[model samples]
Target: MESNLINKDEEVIRRSKTEIVLKLLEYLKPYKLKSFIVILLMIIVMICGIINPLLLEIAIDNYVVNKNVEGLMIIGAALVIINLIAWILSKIRWTMITSVTNNILVNIRHQLYSHIQTLSFDFFDSRPVGKILARVVGDVNALKNLFSQSIQSFIPQLLNLVCVAVIMFILNFKLALACTILLPILGIAMFYIEIHSRRRWEVYRNKRSNLNGFTHEDFSGIKVVQGFAREKETEKNFKAMVKELGDAFIKAVKLNDFFWPLVELSWGAGTLVVFFVGYKLITNNEIKIGTLIAFLMYVGMFWRPIMNLSNFYNTLITNFSAADRIFDILDVKPVIKNSKNAKNIGKIHGTVEFKNVSFSYDDNTEVLKNVSFKVNKGERIALVGPTGAGKSTIISLLSRFYDPTSGEILIDGKNIKYVDLESLRSQMGIMLQDTFLFSTTIMENIRYGRLDASDEEVIAAAKAVNAHDFIMKLEKGYHTEVNERGSRLSLGQRQLVSFARALLANPRILILDEATSNIDTETEKLVQSGIEKLLYSRTSFVVAHRLSTIRDCDKIMVIDNGRIAELGNHDELIRKKGIYYDLYMTQYKFLNE
Candidate 1:
């Protein structure tokens, strides 16, 4: 996983540099009119900037030298008013530019989030939550400056550079030529710095993602760490990750620090060349003092923009790495999505068929192979299998969490792949062995199954699942907090709530994976009644650990090595004395022991 994060093919990296920039810039199209107005304001601001020094030159050369007090006062008053007007226009431009750019950022973030929701389960299986959050939260935030400052800062500085260069040449060509010699040299130096620094920034970003992944992984499993007395070991691992991230950052910063010094050196060199040449020209009377002073002022003005642009470029170089990561996520097409001509069946009758269906995780290791099955609209089937025998994979495929590599899964004689995903999934209920409850009140968590369910309906669902009695035992009843992953609830209690949630959905098809495994025998009887209610008139698949559900199921299939080794009810399977017979015997013996 770490290798995948840091290593990029040369071609991929080269292509992304261009693609990421163009993709980021595309967000501006929606607000182009406001952007254009900001550009016009920037030009006006640069015009005001250019005129100030020229006005200063005029007052010094014409008014002061001629000893005209009234002329000096007039030029001085004009300078103050021009600067005041420039400041006001700048304020207006900042407000407008921020509004436009902030809107663009918000839109991009939302689009990225919505895109993530459409991605396949396999996409998440290959990534850590922290790494995903880094892109959605951290990387997107990094782009805020790129938009907000691009119009207000980069464009104005660029215009200033152009205006300064043109004015310098117009004022005196020879002095301008001498002063401008350092421009290309500095540009080349900064270009080299940008290339090297970008590579370091990419490394830093990858390290930060790795650190986030580790931090999230550790905290999520902190209970295991403490239980096993591995706190010191975990602490050491966390320190190593943090140090690696810090080192990567320091290396990038060390390279980035070269920019300011290079800018300062180039500015000093340009100013010295202009001063020496202008002094010689003045001694020769080839130019006036006012022109020489203006040339010096233009040289200084020119370097200020160069410095600002270099900073902006530095910002772009740093942020482009983050942008590339973000685009990488957006570029991932979901492995499971609706076909172009997909149908919305609206509602299904719950009949499910797996026609020679086969599946693999990575198209390499097969989990299920040409397995065929049929379930009637209201039949309940129990699957019994050893660990890694592809029992859970069956339900996952039925839920359309993944697509089969070969054959088809159909509902009501319609291919699931040809059905609209939202409509198809809305009619199914899934409950897992490890039921996950959100950090909210039980009422809200139960309501998650059907968002518009009334409070009374929610309570009724809880009662149907036999969760209401235990829930009422809490101080706040249904309003009691579950906390993260329902840490405050017992394993059986949490499963009961999940059963309630699934019941509230009132799906036509239901999947319960080891739902009765963790409960005590007494609790199991209560849950069994709820399960019976949930399965009434609905097609249901049960992967069970206990004997009662298996004995009562309409059919029991013993799966082995991705194939159906035995299929029958308990009495028939025992009479046949096959794999299911052995499994049933072992389970019953264990329960008796």
Candidate 2:
């Protein structure tokens, strides 16, 4: 798993930075008008800055030296007004660009989340939930600065750099040429530093993702950790992961720290060149002291932009990995999606057929092989199987959570592959072995099955599943709040609520995959009665290991190694004394013992 993750990181790094930038720009297209206004404001601010030094040079040479006090006062007033105007424009520019970048972030995050929802189970099955959450939450947020800085800082500073250099040359070409001699060398050094720096940031991001995954898993399973007295062990593992993340962050920061000093060194060197060259020109009486002073100011102005641009580049290299990770998720095409020609399979009659269907979660192993089955409408079928015997796989295929590797699944004589997924799933109610409840009231959790269900209807569903009695005993009855996964409720109570939820859906096809496995014997008897009522007039498939619970099922199939080993009514199967008979006898004997 670690090696595969390493390969994925390397692949992400190999993606062109230009590709990431171009993809990011697409999000900005919607706010182009606002962005244009921002750039225009920036241009105005740049012009004001360029004129300031020139105005100072004029005031010193033309007014200050000649004892023209009134002229110097006018120049000083003009400088103050121009600066005020520039400051106001900068404020407006910052506000407008901030709105644009924020909007872009919202759009990108929304797109990523919507796409992830459409992805198939296989995508999620192969990754930890914490790792996926890191991409959706942490990685998307890292891009916030990238977009804001690109418009508000990167473009403005780049333009400032060019404009400053141009004015410097126009004022004194000799000094300008001498000051900029080290630029090419600085550029080359930044280029090499950026290449190494970007890789470090990518590593840092990967380590952060790993830490998030570990933390999420550790906390979610805290019950097991404490129950087994493994808190110290888990803590040790968590500290190691935190240390790994911290080390990666420090390495990236070290490279970034080198960036500012390098720019400052070049700026200082350029200053020395300007003074040395300007002194020679002064000695020849080619340039006045006022002109040399202005030249010194321009040198400061030039390197300021270089420093800002370098910071922008630093922001880009550090957060570009985040952009790349976001796009990686966006680029993933959902393997299971509605086909172009697919149409709604409106209101299926619950006749299900799996014709020579085979499936595999991956390339190396087949979970199900040449499995064929058919069921008529309103029939109750029970599947009895050993662990990993492909019983659940069959149910997953029928629900179209996954498509068969080969062959076809049909409902009401229509191929499910050509059915609109939403339409098909709407008519089926599925309850899994694990029950999940949101952090909401019990009434709300049951209502989740049918969003439009009224309070009375929700209560009725609860009554039908034997959940109403227990619920009424709570302080708030149905309105009592529960934590995530119904952690506040007992395992049996949670299962009862899950049962009520499925009952409320009123699906044409009902699937119970070990739905009563967690309930106590007394509660299971209550739920079993509800189950019989819920199964009436619906095509239902119940998967259970407890043979007694499924004895009254119309037909029982004993599955072994991905094939139906025996299929018959309980009496017929008992008479045959086959796999089903053995399983039933074993459980029956264990109960008596």
- Name the best candidate (by lDDT): 2
Evaluate all candidate structures by whole-model CA lDDT and list the values in order: 0.86, 0.89
Stretch of 10 with least lDDT, candidate 2: 1-10
What range of 10 consecutive residues in model 1 has the weakest lDDT sum? 3-12
lDDT of 1 by residue, 1-593 (tens): 22233222211143355676678779989888998899898888788889988998898888899999999999989888888988999899889987997798788789889999999887787677777877788888888888876776777788789889998888889998998898788889888998899888888888888777778877898899999999999888788878988999999999999999999998998899889999999999999998888778888889888888888788888888888877777887888899999889788898889999888987578999899988888988999889889999999999899998899998999999999998999999999988899999999999999999999999999999899999999999999998899999999999899999999999999998988788887788888889889999999999976666768888887888987788878789889988887877898888789
lDDT of 2 by residue, 504-558 (tens): 9999999999988899998987887788778989999999998888888888878
| 414: Cα error in model 2, Å | 1.1
TM-score of each: 0.96, 0.97
What alpha-carbon RMSD in Å does predicted model 1 have with respect to the real structure? 2.1
* Candidate that would win on TM-score: 2
Alpha-carbon deviation at 412 in model 1, angstroms:
0.2
C-alpha lDDT of residue 553 in model 1 = 84
